[model samples]
Target: MSSPPEIGTAAAVQVQEVEHVYGTGADAVTALGPISLDVPRGSFLVIVGASGCGKSTLLRLIAGFEQPTSGAVRTAGERPLPGAGAGVVFQQPRLLPWKSVGGNVELALRYAGVPREERARRVPELLERVGLHNVAHRRIWQLSGGQQQRVAIARALAGDDPLLLLDEPFAALDALTRERLQEDLRLVSERTGRTSVFVTHSVEEAVFLGSRVVVLTKRPGRIALDLDIPLPRTGLEPDELRALPEYGALRAVLSHAVRDAAG
Candidate 1:
C-alpha cells in the first residue's frame, strides 16, 4: 500500500478558518466553524461531537455538498467539487431498489467512467473488498441491513476517489454489526491507503477508527479537542485492542469532552 505523505508535508485536506450558516438576516443560524483543520493523506481522521454540533455540517463542507458561508474547504489544495474528488457514504444505505447488488456497484463504476468491459472484473473486486462475496445477483431488499450497507460501501469505493467521507454510516446498525463494519472499514482504508474523514457521535467509534480525532463544541461549532490516537493501527483483534487501558482512557476523555461541549 502507498504510504501517507511525510508528517510535515502538504495535507490531503485543508479546512481554513471555515464557517457555515443557514438562512439570512435575523433568522440566520450559524452551524459550523470559524474552525480550521488539516487531514494528512492516507490518515483516518474522525470528527466527533454531540448532536447538532455541526459534525455532519463539517463533513458536508469537505464533501463540497455545500460551500461554506465563510472561509474555504480544499482537497489536495483545490476547491472541492461535489461528487468529484471524494466518495461519500451517509447513515442510510440509499441503494436503488430496482438494482441488483452487483448492478448498484456497476452503475457507480459507469458514472466513474470505468469501461463496460472493466466493470465485469471491478464489480466483484470492490464488493469483496467490503467483505461482500458472491451476492452480486441478489436484489437489494433480499439482503439484510448490514449487507445492504456493505453494498453502499462498495458503490462508494467504485468511484475510486482520493478521499472518503463518511457521516455516521454505521450509526443505525446493531452493536455487533456496527463493530464488524468498523473493523472492515479500518482494514479497507489500510489496504487502499486512502485519506478518510468520518463523523460520528460514538466516542468509542471515533477512537477506534481515527489516526487523529477532533471534537467540536456545541452550536456554531469550533474545535474543542484535537488529539492523535496512539493505538496500534494493525495487529491484534478489534476486541483485544479495545480492551487495552489506553483505549479506555481516550474514550473517557472524548466522552467527557463531548458532554462539556454540549453545554
Candidate 2:
C-alpha cells in the first residue's frame, strides 16, 4: 500500500510555542518546550539530547500520547490523537510474546482498518522492507532482540501511516545489532519516503539517520540546535557514508552542542 499523502498547507507536524508542565503549584516541573518546529513531508527528522532534556517528551506530543500544557501540536494540520495516522515504535519492541510475528502486524493492520485480504499481502512485504524474511510465523520471543525490534517497525508501518514516531527504538540493542538496524531503518525510511521523527541521545545515530537533526537543551528542553544534514541519504554503504569528511564534521558539531546543552 502507498503511504498517506501530506495534508493541507502546514507541514506534516507543526508545533507552535508548545510548553508542557508535569505538575501544578510550586512543585510543578516543566518538562518540555515553549518551542516550535515544522517537519516537512518525507523528512527524516531526528531529535537528540542528553538525559532529562525532554527528547521523548517532544516525541510524545507529536505522537499524541501527551498534549502540551500551553500552545499547540499538530499532525497533518489537525490536533494529533493517539493511534490516529501515526505509527510509533519505542525503546522496547512492545510485541505480544504469544503471537506470531505476522499476527502482530496483521492485528495492527486490522486496527488501521485495512481489509483482511490486503493484510495478507502486506505483512510479509513490510517485514521484507525491514530486512526480515521467512520468519513471519515464528514466535516473537524466539527471535533475537534486533529481530523483535524489526517486527515492531513492521507493525508500525502496517497502516501506511504518513508519520513514523520512533523514540530511541535502537537504544537497548548491542552495538552491532544497533548498527544493522540503523542501516535497515535508513533504507526503510528511504523506501517509504514517509515523514519520521526519531528521538535519540546518540549524536552519531542522529547524524546517521536524520536528513535534519534537532538538538535539545537540558531541563525545559529548548531547541539548542537545528541542523540540516547534507550527507547522501542513499546509494552508499554505511562505512562509506561514515568515512566522509562532512559526516565526521557534523558529528563533532553535534557532540559539542549536546555537551553544552546538557551543561
Candidate 3:
C-alpha cells in the first residue's frame, strides 16, 4: 500500500477570532466563537461542550455553510467554500431515500468530479473503508441506522477533501454500535491521514477520538480547555485503550471541564 500523505506541514483549518450571530439588532444572538483554533494536518481534533455552546455553529463556519459575523475561517490557507475544502457528516445520515447505497456514494464521487468509470471502482472501496462489505445495492431504508451512518461516512470519504468535519455523527446510535463505529473511524483516520474535526458533547468520546480536545464554554462558546492526548493511536483495541490510567485521567479532566464550562 502507498504511504499516507505528508499532512503535518501546516494547519489544515484555522478559526481566527470567529464569531457567529443568528440575527441582527434586538433579535441578534451571538451563537458562537470570538474564539480561535488551529487544527493541524492529519490530526483528529474533537470539539466538546454543552448543547448550546455553539459546537454546531462553529462546525458550520468551518464548512462554509455560514460565514462568521466577525473574524475569519480558513481551510488549507484559503477561505472555505461550499463543496470545497471539507467533507461533512452530520448527526443524521441525510442520504437520499431513493438512492441505493453505492448510488449514494457514487453521487458524492460524481459531485467530486470523479469520472463515471472511476466511480464504480471507487464506491466499493469507500464502503469497505467504513467496514461495509457488499451492501451496495440495498436501499437506504433497508439499512439499519448504523449502516446508514456508515454510508454517510463512505460518501464523505469518496472525495479528496483535505478535512473531515463530523458533527456528532454517532450521537444517535446505541452504545455498542456507536463504540464500533468510533473504532472504525479512528482506524480510518490513521490510515488516510486526513485532518478531521469531530464535534460531540461526550467527554469520553472526545478523549477517545481526538488527538487534541477542545472544550467550549456555554452560549457564545469560548475555549475552556485545550488538551493534547498522548495515548497510542493504534495497536491496542478500544477497550484496552480505554482502560488505561492515562485515558481515565484525561476523561476525568475533560469531564470536570465540561461541567464547569456548562454552568
Cα-based TM-score, every candidate: 0.95, 0.96, 0.95
lDDT for predicted candidate 1 compared with the true structure? 0.90
Worst 10 residues of 2 by lDDT: 1-10
For candidate 3, write residues 113-232 as lDDT tens digits. Answer: 999999999999999999999899999999999999999999999898889999999999999999999999999999899999999988989999999999999999999999999997
TM-score of 1: 0.95
- Sort the predicted structures by lDDT, highest score first: 2, 3, 1
Q: What tens digits encode model 2's per-residue C-alpha lDDT throughout 1-263?
A: 12223335469998887888998999999998778889999999999999998999999989899878887788989989999989999999999988899999999999999998999999999989998999999998799999999999999999899999999999999999999999999989998989999999999999999999999999999999999998975679999999999999999999999999999
What CA RMSD would you report for each candidate?
4.9, 4.7, 5.8
Candidate 3: stretches off by over 4 Å: 1-9
Give the distance in Å from residue 95's predicted Cα in candidate 2 to where it truly belongs. Answer: 0.3
Report lDDT per candidate. 0.90, 0.92, 0.91
Q: Give RMSD (Å) of candidate 1 vs. truth.
A: 4.9
Task: List runs of model 2 lying over 4 Å from the truth.
Answer: 1-8
Model 1: per-residue Cα lDDT at residue 144: 90
Q: Once all C-alphas are superposed, what RMSD does model 3 give against the true structure?
A: 5.8
Question: What lDDT is reached at residue 102 by model 2?
Answer: 95
The TM-score of predicted model 2 comes to: 0.96
